[model samples]
Target: MINPHKQQIIKPKKAVIKWLLDSDPAIRWQVMRDLTKEPDEFIVAERKRVATEGWVAQLLALQDADGKWGGVIFPAKWASTFYALLLLRDMGLEPTSEQARKAVSLVRHKVTWGQEHGNSPFFEGEVEPCINGRVLALGAYFGGASDQLVDRLLSEQLEDGGWNCEAPPSRRSSFNTTICVLDGLLAYENAKGACTAVTDARLRGQEYLLVRGMFRRLSTGEVIDRSWLRFSFPPTWHYDVLRGLDYLRSARVEPDEQVIEAVDLVAKKQHQNGRWPLQNPHLDQVNFAMEGPAATASRWNTLRALRVLDWYYR
Candidate 1:
């Protein structure tokens, strides 16, 4: 496994870097911190713009007075407040900003899992490992996720060292559910500081991916899902190669033989121009376009892929 430490950042093409930097504050700040290694002050200053500019502003403006987006708690259209929070987390909205505090506070007081889950508070989370995992991440990021939520998630872990929303009937873990839970669990650890149970579960979850080579069926050694090769942003609950690699990068997992194939797939996806195309764009019903339609150069996917590659190669 490769340890990602004070390793030098990889030098992406200047034009590609320019393309990335010239865009939304959400993406630009990440590029500075991860790719360009800008001074923390510059990165912080740029990150603050997310509360006032570009996609972040657009998304925030769509919010209703009720602290809900898309007018639902969790809707099939991805228009729900749940998704809005997820997207905000992905955008790296400055946690301390007034916009973030106000927005999150509204979610905390006004939203609920509805009568179905006993109208559970937003940060308290509802059933379904997939949904709770994302909720855990949002709460942790914005500072509301609870220890009770963490405890519930810990109890639901399947024997396979990962989670499955459909655990009771199938007893088999799922890649989609596993990634969502891992993201939440990791975020919880980062926000609350690691404890033995959370840390152990998180590490075991990583092993589950590593043993399967990230996107393979362990029993037959065949690609589990071809669509996993299609990269996306605001990924929702989907699991893709780039998503898997990016998670490892964020978690600071050491790169090893297990990730070589996945890393190569990301490298191969880059266009001759050095930008990666958006192979998939997870449904956004809110009318906000984070990138051009699929097959076009995508700043979000390109930025994520570049950082993941840097973590792997360095």
Candidate 2:
């Protein structure tokens, strides 16, 4: 009773695997769990190293007296302490780590999404979808079930199957906002294990990305925006073709013919030396380096693009 038409997924190149293994321990642990289906001795050793000497340690060392690492609660609302913790979760920081625990407590006690304080267990008020999404990501990363932010995120999803931070006030969906919401939703689903609404939201969001061919209008076939084509580091939450497609590939969703054009666009960027460039970086202050912002082919961008293309070609 088995169907045999399904194509086998492409395994990452040996060099890629080695590169991942040789990267930071936190990244290595994530690649081992997300990209590799099996955990052997090598993976176990890498995870242990992550526990002992990863960015989590560096971040933990910076925590302030009030349990907030960045000296303020929800500092800027977009890319603040709340946002950083969300990204750290996606980076595969252990939820039980003291750093993560402190962040969770700080946000829970000191932040409010809306006007009322103590009105709801989740941040109260006119919550932005992307903000809710980030909080959902934090809760899910820490294995905190019964966190209702997941429901709030879904409620704010725009009609185009994406999200917009300005949607509540302006009622307009935006490419950048949609992408951040998608990333947060993916992290949430990965942590929750099973959720039908989350699954549907993710698929619809993917379709939105695909409908635009990752960076173009379906009707005009014109680039969506100059910014859409540019790649960036720390992403700081933006929608670029590279970031969006990278998400699709990580989710292991099958790429159809529609996605090939985008895949090809990304592949063409590889230099003769077989690496991708860093292109540009989002303007923000951050603690670490995920990539280099120069003409040289960056290791981070290269690894991400190669993995996606490899999956597509297979």
Candidate 3:
């Protein structure tokens, strides 16, 4: 029997659907598959456009000869190879495509973690759980991640049901670090099938967020961080309400009462014109500006917000 909550359909507002359909292939394909539910062939054809056109193409064209973007392999700056790959993953670049294969190969052969760690492989990951979590996601999707990488993440799970980049020093888990790891684990499951350990770890990480209503402090019932309420694209390593809720939506966890406040917050952000605005993003040296500074209507946020609503309020 179909699970009603899991399968509920929320037809987007007609104007919103039309607006989303008129954007980049990266956004348009997802709109069709997730929002409009277009025929499979239509969805497949649209998804293919991402490899050779739009932002994927723009970012791929920026790749340096050394398989890095913005002249570095990985760095604190947002324009580096790490972020470019993260953005491409979010854009839904077809993993099987020849174009994607070539772009990823460059990084596979050239990118490394630098001399500090004796030049660790890109997919093998670095010390920080936040960075390793993202590497696991990218590796699982574009190619595959090593078992050591996966097991390392699983072992890092905090007693509180999440992970913290500052675990030994700070026993508490962090929203940002936890979200990154959860996303990686989900992608790993999707790519290589699940394990009991992975599933259990994921559930615990999710509960950590759910118990806090995804935004407020568990103890004081006060907002944990106001920045979490705002939405952004390429979210980098930050965790916002929309990004966190969208992760829950992708995992298809049953919409529970715990998520009500966060879901409502997302709904209230939609403008009367059936759109959502991009909020102030973490400023970084990005290769290019995808949209105007906060307050502009954001196609990425609108698509994600609408699909999240579809998953939640059924």
Candidate 4:
């Protein structure tokens, strides 16, 4: 029988579809490919823009002579360098572009994060889970990923079925870090179904998010963090409930009762006008405006929330 809980998921509205299509070409590409039905030509045209004038160009402009986005191996901010590249790949940036080629060359030259390299850059040679996750994603994009990197990511999976950035030092599993890893793994899984290690690691990581109701505490039943409620644009590395839920739904995970709590949380935020607001922004040198931070309705956040809600409720 069709689950009664599933009845709540709704058919996506035209406004929501248009909004998703109109937003980031990278996200649009994900939605376009995942839609139960194929989107019209208009959506395809927008995805093509990634190649024409969007992030592919933006990231290219940010590149330095060394071929990395930020001059350092891993910028002080862990998410920006590799995670940002994954965002561009998600948008459908062609790997063959000159900028992409340069970026790939730079990544290959610096670190032994993947198997193509001769030795581990560090004495331990074991990379942090998040780093391996992003490197796996980069390799997936350029068809250069090796079994070694996938093995590293799989080995790092924590007891909770998620990943933790503070592996040897902190040791506490984290929500944000787990999502970032999942994002990269899912991208790799979709691109090439060849690697079982990445596939298993991703499945467990996804279970962790779902067990927490995507945004709430498993035992306490409280919202995990205030920041989880805030929606952000270009979600650098921070994991809001909105991004987590969207990722789950996009990956076609079955929604259980645990997801209902998250669904309720997101639903309450939608305004009477059927929109969500941008609660945060990436602290970057350049960004596009979405009204202001909190006052106006954010077209991007609304599109993401509504689509996720629609899929789950149906």
Clashes of each: 2, 2, 0, 5
Worst 10 residues of 4 by lDDT: 1-10
lDDT of 1 by residue, 263-292 (tens): 777887878788889886776575577777
Error of 4 at 102 (Å): 4.9
- Give the alpha carbon lDDT tens digit for every residue of 44-102 in model 2: 76665654575656655655555454654365532356656655665666567665566
Per residue, candidate 3 scores C-alpha lDDT tens digits across 10-51 of 655688789888878999999999888899999999999998
Query: Predictions ranked by TM-score, top down?
Result: 1, 3, 2, 4
lDDT over C-alpha atoms for residue 287 of model 1: 52
Judge candidate 4 at residue 285 and give its lDDT.
43
Residue ranges of candidate 2 with Cα displaced over 4 Å: 1-22, 30-38, 76-79, 97-99, 102-126, 145-147, 168-172
What lDDT would each prediction earn against the true structure?
A: 0.87, 0.65, 0.87, 0.66
Model 1 stretches astray by more than 4 angstroms: 1-9
lDDT of 4 at 123: 15
Predict model 4's lDDT versus the native: 0.66
TM-score of candidate 4 versus the correct structure, residues matched by position: 0.77
lDDT of 3 at 266: 86
Q: Write the per-residue lDDT of candidate 4 for residues 208-313, one digit (tens) a residue.
A: 8877777777789787788887788667668988888988876888777877767777777776555677786774544233346664677667667767876776
